[model samples]
Target: EEVKEKAQDVKKEAEVKAEEVKEEVKEKAQAVKEEVKEEVKEEKAEIENKIASTGNYPDLITSLKNNPWTSGDLNTRVKFEDIRRQVTLHEEEITDLPLDKIKTSLSPESLVDFLNMTSAKPTILNRKEDTSYEFTTRDPKEIDLIKKRYGLLDREIDKITSVLIFDKEGQKLKEVKDVLAEGKNRIYMETKF
Candidate 1:
């Protein structure tokens, strides 16, 4: 009878130990689950941030469109158009003017002064009596037009450069977000299994 009672006690002790082990395992599993959830939340937040940053691309495009140099200024645009017409007329006149007459008509001193004012580099032509200066003009009036156009072009280029930098940063963020998202998904799948 004593042996029987001792065997029963041993069985009860073993059962209690098994229950304790089960409770410990359950707590550990809960801890792991909470950790995974926190990680997933963090990953989602990071992805959301990446998406928001990329979403600013449209605003950048709008800012470029609304820039005063590009679209907002009307006077510069009209001036550029007028200069373009004048340049066309001048090009036609160039064909009629004899090369020597054209050379003689343009005063060397005035030409040099104009070059200095415009900060243009003068090409020196080899001549016997008088030094012939050739001013290679891509339509002086058209050049003025492009100068006006540059106000717009410069702003656009700057905006574009900014947007490109933003895009690169956004892309890197997106890649990181993707990796995090994938990791989260893997964790989710593992949890399910």
Candidate 2:
């Protein structure tokens, strides 16, 4: 009777241990599933941020192509409008510069003063209707500075334009991908039991 009780106790202990192990495994599996879900969510968020930053205009373009409509063509129209606005603003800013005031501020001995006093500024000298005067400075350092500034501005404009283009392209690609995915699903459904 003592041996039988000892065996029963051992069986009960083994069963309890098994239950504990099963519970631990379940908890671990749940933890792993949650971790995977969080990682997937983070990855998706990152991609969304990238797409948003680039303007995702391509999607609009793609939608337009897939289903053409006069009013629904937002991508091209918006791009054109943005370019026009930027050009206009640039022109206005350039015109607002006080060129005459700047020239008067310089001493008569300075090269700019000499040019101003003599009206040697190419734009002032070459007043031809068809020909436009291009400013060319002999000082390499000054020229380099000017070139750098010009390049910087050019790069900024290019960056903006690129983002717009990227958006349009991305949108189109997404639409195409969706269509392909649908077709693949249809094919899979037709083939599978």
Candidate 3:
């Protein structure tokens, strides 16, 4: 009995730490998004300057290919003719370079797994009694903070509009830097301990 209780306590603590890491991942993702935006802007400006300096079709084509710039939605390898037609028709936004597709698409919850917060077995979350049916936290400090932030004191629970449960299935790969198309479901757990 004592061993079982200790194991539960450890699992709970690990889960709490995972939640904290998830928040950190969100912050990092936002930062990465900002950095990628700046880099793309710089790359686009440099390419545009080069193209303007060329002042000739042949030189422009060479500059386009050598510079390695791409329209956000276009293929990795684009011809000068295709670029000219696209620009003429205004069908594409060539200046907008989406360099970090993964960072933009990936949810913060999934990023936590990539960060490898710890070798935590999430079986502790399998118990039904451990889940939240509402957006309320059980922690006194967090609850107080939320109440203060939202300016709600002793507010009664209004009827729930909807509860959505998203299920995620994936194997945590080791030493992988590839972008994952999908994301994991975040477990928002609030404990009194």
Candidate 4:
């Protein structure tokens, strides 16, 4: 009878130990499940942020396609739209150059091409505060039109004895004596400082 009692006590202890182990395993499983849930939530949030950041491309491309000014052959329009998207995306990286009184201008088509060419990466040089801007276009006619419209300064360097400055309407603003004969042309004849 004593042996039977001892055996029963031992059996009870083993059952208690088994229950404790089962509870511990259940707690561990719950912790693991919670960890997985948190990780999934974090991943989902990252994906949402990524989508928000880049979601404007499709809509912008659509707008470009529908734009009357940009309309053309389907292939060409598509190429331009792609370039436009790249430009818009990286516009913040392009430096804002301080412009002077000499307003530089370019045709719409040429400007689009230039932007497309430089959209991959942007590198703009910082100029002095009083720097004037001079623009050159491949079309000489366009240059003349811009000069007429914006009163841009004209600098001549081919054995010219004088430099002439003209207003927007071709009126002579000033004529400066060119003392240096090195053929170095200057658009702005005088510095403010």
Q: Predict model 3's lDDT versus the native.
A: 0.32
Candidate 3 segments whose C-alpha is farther than 4 A from its true place: 53-55, 58-193
Give the candidate number with the greatest TM-score: 2
Q: Among all windows of ten consecutive residues in candidate 1, which has the lowest summed lDDT?
A: 184-193
Q: 2 or 3, which is superior by lDDT?
A: 3
Whole-structure CA lDDT of model 4: 0.33
**Candidate 3 C-alpha lDDT tens digits along 41-137:** 8877765444432222233233233434232322221111133233221214332223233213322222222122222222212223232112222
RMSD of each: 28.5, 25.1, 30.8, 23.1
Candidate 4, residues 103-131: lDDT per residue as tens digits?
22222232223222221222222244221
Question: For candidate 2, lDDT tens digit of each residue in 80-150?
Answer: 11232333222223443332332222111121222222222333122332222223333434333322322
Candidate 1: give the clashing pairs: none
Against the unseen true structure, what C-alpha lDDT does each candidate score?
Answer: 0.31, 0.30, 0.32, 0.33
Encode model 1's per-residue lDDT on 70-184: one tens digit a residue: 1222111011112323333232333322323222222212222333333334354334432323233334442342223223222111111000111321221110000001111
- lDDT, candidate 3, residue 169? 18
Candidate 4, which segments miss by more than 4 Å at Cα?
53-193
